[model samples]
Target: MARSIFPFLLLFLFTYYYTGVQSHEEGYVTAEISNKGLEFLKDLLIEKAESSLVPLELPKIEKSVKIPIIGSVQMVLSNITIEKIHVTSSTVKTGDTGILIDVSGATANLSMNWKYSYSTWLLPISVSDKGSATVQVEGLDIGLTLSLNTLQGSLKLSLLECGCYVNNISIKLNGGASWLYQRLIDAFEGKISSSVEDAVSKKLKEAIPKLDSVLQSLPKEVSVTDIAELNVTFVDEPELSGSSLDLQINGLFYAKNEVAHSKHYHKMLKASDSCNEADKMVKISLHENVLKSASSVYFEANKMHWMVDEVPDQSLLNTAGWRFIVPQLYKKYPNRDMNLNLSVSSPPIIEVENQRISAIIPLDFVIDILDADELIPVACISMVISSSGSAEISGHALAGNLKLNDFTMSLKWSNIGDFHMHLIQTVMSTMLKTVILPFANLKLSKGLQLPVFHGYELQYAQILCTDSWIVICSDVAPVEQLRLV
Candidate 1:
């Protein structure tokens, strides 16, 4: 019985010790595998940098990883196909430090062609890091992209410690234009450049305090330092359209979880002059029926006002530029103070497809000064604007027939005969004839009578002529008057 008992004890002890050893060894192996993966990532990043149009260099690698495994493993990856590859290196030490990263040889190719009204993104990145003998890491980068819009930014810190200097850490991104453009826009916005430096600077300034908070929360064992500078450049300009944009950005970032650094840039080409001015503010509040594709649009200007304060320098570029016709309004109401209160329920409904515009516009006009005189004030020149068809206008001058709401004016002036006849011909040939012929021809007539005013009989009591323009002398105290010219 003693002999049997001794054998059983020996077997039990052996099994217990072997199981403990295997558990410890498995943990160690998992750590090593993770560290090797980090090294491989670093190497991959170097390769990408070497092949890029704008290469980058980072100072160090800071990372952490966790994995579940069965046996010892060694991973050696020769070549892996990826849409984009990135690398960042940061120093690992005891206190404050700098970070640097080198990025190069990142390539992007459209994997599949599918048109989408609204697009999204998915980012996959692999991370590899080596630290103390007890811990190791292998990681993949994962992120999100939605359409070709833009990205904000993110700073990740691994709260671990180690004296072992990380040599290489690589990150890879794989996606289509939807993901690429958003990332590029974000990175470009992150860098400081002359084109959009102010916008990017403001962003960085706001981010610095958050970065400091991250640094302060790091674990005691980890000492992060040595941040490397990053550079960003684009392969091509991002074409901003409705749903699609093509672009790419290559850059590097280097910093331990305990250290903080950031870069930002903003670039805008063909920017409007109104973008900088603050005094001229425009506020557009339109109903939902304005755009077919949009439910509603509310545009507010911080500096330049399109209608009230000052006309936009390049109003033509605005989406609603045509609605607020600056040139026509300027010429029509020069030196006049008018409150532009015009609203429309819908765009012109063309009864005829190619030649006409039939829109329902609720109009209200206030004219302070007519010609050079400030005494005449026309209030509420309101009318429903409903017109269509195109008319061919020609010639320089040809004044004859004119009519306005039961009122008629004719002319016989010889003092202005020297002016070009082509003006008269062109003015009468087109829509302007409604005003031009009545004003020009009526001025030469012996006398004129205005339509009734407040049921009171008021007629043009006098006529005054000058070398350049014509004026009507009315005796009924001009309260609300409508002059075609």
Candidate 2:
């Protein structure tokens, strides 16, 4: 009669224990990476630009002029070298349309050799000259319009301002006659200025595509394990500010083989009001649904198990009431002749309520009695356990500490002849408090973490839990050694 009523008793206890507990619906997560945390990106851009835009060379320039007194005047300039280019100031603006990068107060220095010859038709006299000149450019302004191409996973840069002014010019006439000095200087300046503008413009256009290619090659999806992959998709147009840029991302966290085959598209970036002073550098908000989904995945994968087979001390057996129920058995067999296995009987159910996270995990516990000849199954118990906990940021990962608040158990089957049923319950409860629950807490403490960025580190992180989601905000800064991806 007791065995027949066991299932109903177990159900009643579980229902009564979880009667007022709340449940949450599963969903996705949204992350907002603020601009204040993006200072390192500006420095990186400047460094890459300086190293790439150097030793710029222009092809030989030739011009012919028909003069009345000196007929068929021909001029040629060759071997032009732009040795130095510097960017003094930079500004980035974000709007609904796209991002605008304004680089101003730039400077460049150029040097080239020139040659000219003219022949007089009537006098039959010919004159030739050669000279070298240095050109200094200042107040250079360059503006670029940046946009993301979602299909290709790349950034596109277009010229907004491609202009500069001549700060100073020095001319050294090696062989040109004194009478033609002024005329030669005027001609050289015109040709060199036009050539320099075109060369710089062309280089800027070429470099951006290469940069896009490099960014595209970076892995978009991070594999957490064989069973899970986190798809980090940029869901909206990026925003740029004075100190940093913000990217709106949606993480499509799913189990392996569960991802959609169709391509995912991002919404266009809409302009937002300026950020507040208290805004941190890196901000990420995860919806409660994400965690709920992960729990389901873990349950489906059958990965939740807490097992203990170590030999228990004689004291523990005695305190657990095992000696009282089976004194003769313990006297004949050692404490090492026992093993315990606990596995999830059903998927763990997680919910957030009362400013805390809670979970109800159904468990199956099997106890085996080991003999010198063979191992014999002694008892099987079914348990439903509940825990409540809070989450904290430990290093780069989120750690959780859960306390086992309540549980209900019932005997499924038992082979221990003449053993008191209440004694088994006492032993199971003792083992749960001493061994099983602590191991579960240890596993929960490891928690989950975000992927690390190569050149940046996170600090002063704050976590906030709301009705819909959890938000993590942090300040990001450059490390001493920048690791390029």
Candidate 3:
């Protein structure tokens, strides 16, 4: 009976103490929950703040919810619009204990026509589409996890066949060389990246020392990983003509310090890939259509940028300048016949430090024109131009054989009469020697000098007197001359 009584007393004491402890615990939870909402709100503000020592203003702290088991804090905010968002201060409440803080807000005066946007730069830099985001905070670091969902603009990267809209955008760069390079490539290739690159490059050139200082502060073995996914609604209509391309990019890399800081860059060109760097880099391809009436004399480099060592020739352009002259001559005058040959070649290389460039033009062809009946004899007309810039022209025509040295001329209607005049003169002179002289009433030696009027005939008729009376008459029947010797 004594032992049982002692056990009963002990049980009563234990029960009283346990009840008291439970009441105290409940009070602590209640107090903690009440204060936790503000704490979590502050954490979100801190995460959004871009600068330290900067205070953020919110209209009100509406509500805060805390989950004791998971140690998560969710706070709803009012009139919470930050001029800028940055990752600044970080605090850890306890070792090995996880705490998550989240803050969210909305504005009544938002313009539906415009996109909402947010961005932050820190160890984990991120930018988002324009809209409201439900930020969930959960991690062991006692920091806020920002989940930003917004209505972002779609990226129209290249002049391709696609119609789409984007509602959100984000960029997260985990430190690495490959990741950094790819981020830079995408950013540069993206709508905003080109401008950003230009600005940065200009600034770096101006502030090399500052850039070096910043680079020095970073890890030498920088490995960057990034996941940039774009949410796009591709518009495809049967009546509309266009292809669709909605894309996301994710990449990783493990590079050494030396490789990370490698000075051997191919100077990332605009649209073309580096030939030498092909093995060291990956490529993303783009597609476009070949329009039926596109300009033929296009520069390949314009499409390929710096990657193309050689540029296509424009001299063969069928629509302009010299080329136009050939085709037009043929098309406009169906009665006249014309032919053309035009070609181009690369020029010799002239090397400069860190650069080598060459150019060539192959403009080689002969053109011949003939009358409708082909009565005119064939002519051999040629133009020869050397890489050294020497030009020679040689030809034969009814105008007589011509040997031209760097000679250039145009054949027009006015010149045609002069050419025919010279030709006619030549043919007439030859025919006179071969035919008219032999049939004329004059005999002449090959080397004899003849009077101009030697071919005239004179006739005199004379009636003879008994003795020798002389009578001369100009008329052939009335002439009288002594006579018949």
Candidate 4:
């Protein structure tokens, strides 16, 4: 009984292994956006803050006081203007809660006009003062929290030091003294501190959302061609590291209506702590199913064709005619004009085996002969060409060179004689190797380029080939002309 069951066990093992391989091949393509690469964005945010946070106007602060010497005094401060605001350092992070932006060591120059009145209850006296003072803020700290809307946020601000130098001061007293000017300066500094904090906070709350709008407006879809479109979808919330932010995105690439519907395993993505240790700024993984889907789409399009317009040499035609037992035919038409055309018989079949990608292309060849200034089709040949190659990441594109492995030809119809069948087969095989394969490689190289980011360029790309997928990893850095909009 044990011997009889041995065949069944072997069959079961084979089935299990085959199914496992198939399941692994039908997986998702993932892209990782690393943190170190996000530093460029931080710099951009700081620059934007410097330009947009300007001409800030503060609220009016009014108070009534009873002074020992100057009784029944009323003071009003308005028209506070802050300018030349500059952010020296900033830190941005993403977490489970939301996004946090902390700015430190900010400085700005401020100028404001102030007016005050003094009235003594013992005498009929009214004193008024009007002047403009300029102040220098040494260190300011701003903390902001941003939600997804980019348009909603809260800002907290504090100032470490503020010094005001009286640029111009004018005092008017109806019947009192000119010594009150110094007291006004001291009081102004005490009250202006709180006003400065409130102004900065309000300005930041307004500016943060505008920054978010700019970030959201960045282009997401990269168009490779009319038929092929790559959709980058963010699958999970971004995580923040000390130096960078990590984003998990789906690399959904398809040829119109050819996108395969598959379940996304977003839970598989884990928060990375050492994002700075990553060598590449971006990583794109492509599953084998993507190739299969694209191949099917190309086959359905049926647009693969090549035409050779040059006339065949008479000597070569004669040599072919002699082999076909039609020597006198070449003499009758020694200078016959002939051209060759090739069309796909069906869609190409792509397969991945043992770390190599291969394609089986079926083609039809038509040879037209010019007679009496009219082209007449003389021969039709059907053939299959098998090619295999290894893929590599070249610059920002997936590039590969296909080597023709096997060529086979059969004559479907030939008015040029049966022996000439061998000649046509030889010519077609040469064309496949020399002309057609190179053309296909060129198209593949140009068509598979990675999408370009606004300021970053791909560098030192590494490609990984696996049993079911290919992974491309590359570093992206700012170009010399990099600009943030």
Candidate 5:
């Protein structure tokens, strides 16, 4: 059962990784699964152990024994099948090198065919009897050490060491003479115990490759948008402690058509105080560079352009709306409709500091005047805006709200003659309050999907912003545990 839990835990634990999370060439993400998290694993493991221990088929065992009078009898036990299993207890512990699992007081019920034959002078012809026997395996114990690492950005699992001890294997014959019981016990007692121990250990070891194969088969990157993909490759090996394990991943946003590269080094990311608390099972930390990667990709794809031809104030799209600000605009084209072509001129520069998610966004707008029912490109304006917000866990991604701060703007060019820089600020202020800020808040509320395991989700999570990194601590439970709760 311990083995069962360890493999599944290894399967989901490090698929999404983070780190001393600095500004890497690419972005970063890391995680810490504390002892609280292991408690959830223990619950899931116990359920799996019940079904996994049965259906174990051991190799056929043949033994040669010299009986008191039968002399030189060959006994073969074939089709040794484990019909039932009971696991009393199992424990999971994190070590300096890797993880350790201990299982004790486990037992199994087995059935096999027992065939024996002996050629003796007492009997003119060789004698043989074929019958069935039931085996009771008791006082079983196993201690295992497993080595978990990242291989080519995928999770890798190896069974480093395993020790299995079985105290007793009592065999009861079904159709045989009275003397056969003691003789069979005297011949097969030690052999049965050894064989049971070996078979049980083998069963536990087989689970590693199967789970490793599952982890390796998962996709390394996920398409987040038409122009970009989320890079989810593990950046480094897990850092193990007495109580928890930390794993880091290269969480960058890669261009859809760009080639990918391997990263071998990163900061050793550890669990923060917010995540190490007893109630929160896992802690996840993300760096600011991750957001920068996304912004860069979207901007490079030329997907940040937005045409604002309609707004709450319909007059904003007409030259009359800007008549007072740009006197010549309305003088030249009276009551003409206008269109504002807005684009993010550059990637937003994001900073995580002092519990705030802040950014500087550069923007450009092209104003088109409708003359004789034909739109005419007039002039363009450039602006820089500042904003701040707090992060939240929205589904699997980090979601947050931002407020635009004070920033200066001026005209980059003008066709209607130069106007005071202060005048343009007033018009932009109205658009930001009535259109841009509210629209941005609404769009950002949905958030983007982060690089997390597809099926698993964090529950009751909390987010904290710090220097160059943000952390979230949360609890997770499988459906079985949810039903129990």
Candidate 6:
């Protein structure tokens, strides 16, 4: 999970440019992380720190020292490597400026090959001793604060301040005579400690800018379908409190084939801060505008139109079945096949309220007759379909359900002349119930996707509909433990 989780989680951790507080619901999308996620953050950072420390080659330490008894002694410690690291304590919190992470009371054990050559002050002979040694580093402390800001629609991170300190270091020389051990420790202990402190602090500073760039590289908009894309750009600066961090994003969808948005004007963002504390690492909130935009996209692409020539009852498409209601239509195209063409007059309007979700769809229904091996328009009817929308958390998406409430129908034009409106109403309703509703319900069962990234997918989730938005709570745990809110 760490592969994508680390970058994405850290990206969530840093919330930039908090706006003032408000009361009403305004944001289209909001993500919140509580203290529970902070605990996970600490552990993940520790693992990341350990991984970054290893496979790091420390520069070789070489120096020449002149002693009273010995002429000139040259010492070199090469092939240095960190063998193990233990983080005994760590703390992370959000500050006024940014996020601060402190790791202290840590220990680092290192191993390096040491060689020394000495020329005696009195004798002309030179003695050389070569062996390996281990260094025990104690009381290692690291402190860092990162500054976050949005740069042209991306989050930018920078190391505001960083510090590393090593209280003491002990070096044990192995192959040389016992007397040389004390002399070597006295000369190299201070140098090794300082090098470690400098190296760690420098590496962290250099990595901050590069990691910042990675966060900035995330896509501003996520594609939903061939013709639709969700605007995932930040709508407002992030807000970080003592207990959690929150982000607001433009969650509305748009037609990708054309540069356009729904008629709804974008509103100011307001992250949900009313949720009680929970173990959930993330809470995502989606507004009604998201649904509105989806309807617009489908309508703009002409995807809502359907040429339904087949149905569960084959006789419904033949002129014999409608002869009694529209006698003229049957006389004109006797015993012929028929097709109903359905299309939306305009984009459907969806509104969210206490009693589920209500929608009004204006649709055009046209009848065509097959005559002389050609399809010919026979009649046209206008209708307003009314339905209520419902959603449930199904796996990674919020599955949707639509149930038809009622509809009003009228004749627009008819080549068959006049017909009884009452007789056709009953038949049309049955056709919709047995044919149109089933097809629409089937498609809606697939569900609407939440905001998602390329490499990461949401799991162990539950949803709740409230006020003007829907709340999704999910965990990073295994799927078997999935629970509902």
Report the Cα lDDT for residue 47, model 1.
Answer: 51
Task: Put down candidate 6 lDDT per residue, 63-171, tens digits, no spaces.
Answer: 8887777767898889877777789899888757778889998999988888888777577788887888888889999999976665555667779899999997888
Q: Of the pair 5 and 6, which is ahead by TM-score?
A: 6
> What are the TM-scores, per candidate, against the unseen true structure?
0.17, 0.72, 0.16, 0.66, 0.83, 0.85
Quality of model 4 by C-alpha lDDT: 0.54
Q: Pairs clashing in candidate 6?
A: none
Which RMSD values do the candidates have, in order? 35.6, 9.2, 44.8, 12.1, 7.7, 7.1
Per-residue lDDT over 1-485 for candidate 2, one digit per residue giving the tens place of the 0 to 100 score? 11211221122111111000011211144444455433345557766787688889987889887777667878887888888888888876655445566778788887777788877866676788877766677766766676643432223343444444444454444445635654755666666777777887788778877877766676555555566555554444445554445544344445677762222322222322222335786556554444555555556676555445543443453223366766644654556356566677776776555346677888887766766776666668788888766766576555665577888877787665454657766766776677655654566566554335665665556665555445556766554432331
lDDT of 2: 0.57
lDDT of 4 by residue, 369-467 (tens): 667888777668788888776766555454555678997888787776654557656765665565555655554455344445565566666655555
- Every candidate's lDDT: 0.24, 0.57, 0.22, 0.54, 0.71, 0.70
Q: Please list the residue runs of candidate 1 whose C-alpha ends up more than 4 Å from where it truly belongs after superposition.
A: 1-359, 367-375, 386-485
Clashing pairs in 4: 35-244, 35-245
Predicted candidate 3 versus true structure: per-residue lDDT over 1-485, tens digit per residue: 01111221121111111000011000100001112223443454354332431222323332223334433223322333223323333432211212223222311111011121223333253322222322111111112322111111111211111111212233332222334233232231233222222332333233334423442343212121121111111111101111111121111111222221111112211222222322211122111100000111122212101111111232221223223333344343344433232222222111111121111222222233445554232222222222111111111000101111121222223212222334323432342244322322122111112111123111221111111111111111111221221
Counting clashing residue pairs in each candidate, in order, gives 74, 2, 28, 2, 6, 0
Among these predictions, the greatest TM-score belongs to: 6
Candidate rank order under lDDT: 5, 6, 2, 4, 1, 3
Residue pairs in candidate 2 whose N, alpha carbon or C atoms collide under 3 angstroms: 27-289, 37-281
TM-score of 1: 0.17
Better of 3 and 6 by lDDT: 6
| Candidate 5 lDDT score relative to the true structure | 0.71
Ranking by TM-score: 6, 5, 2, 4, 1, 3
> TM-score of predicted model 6?
0.85
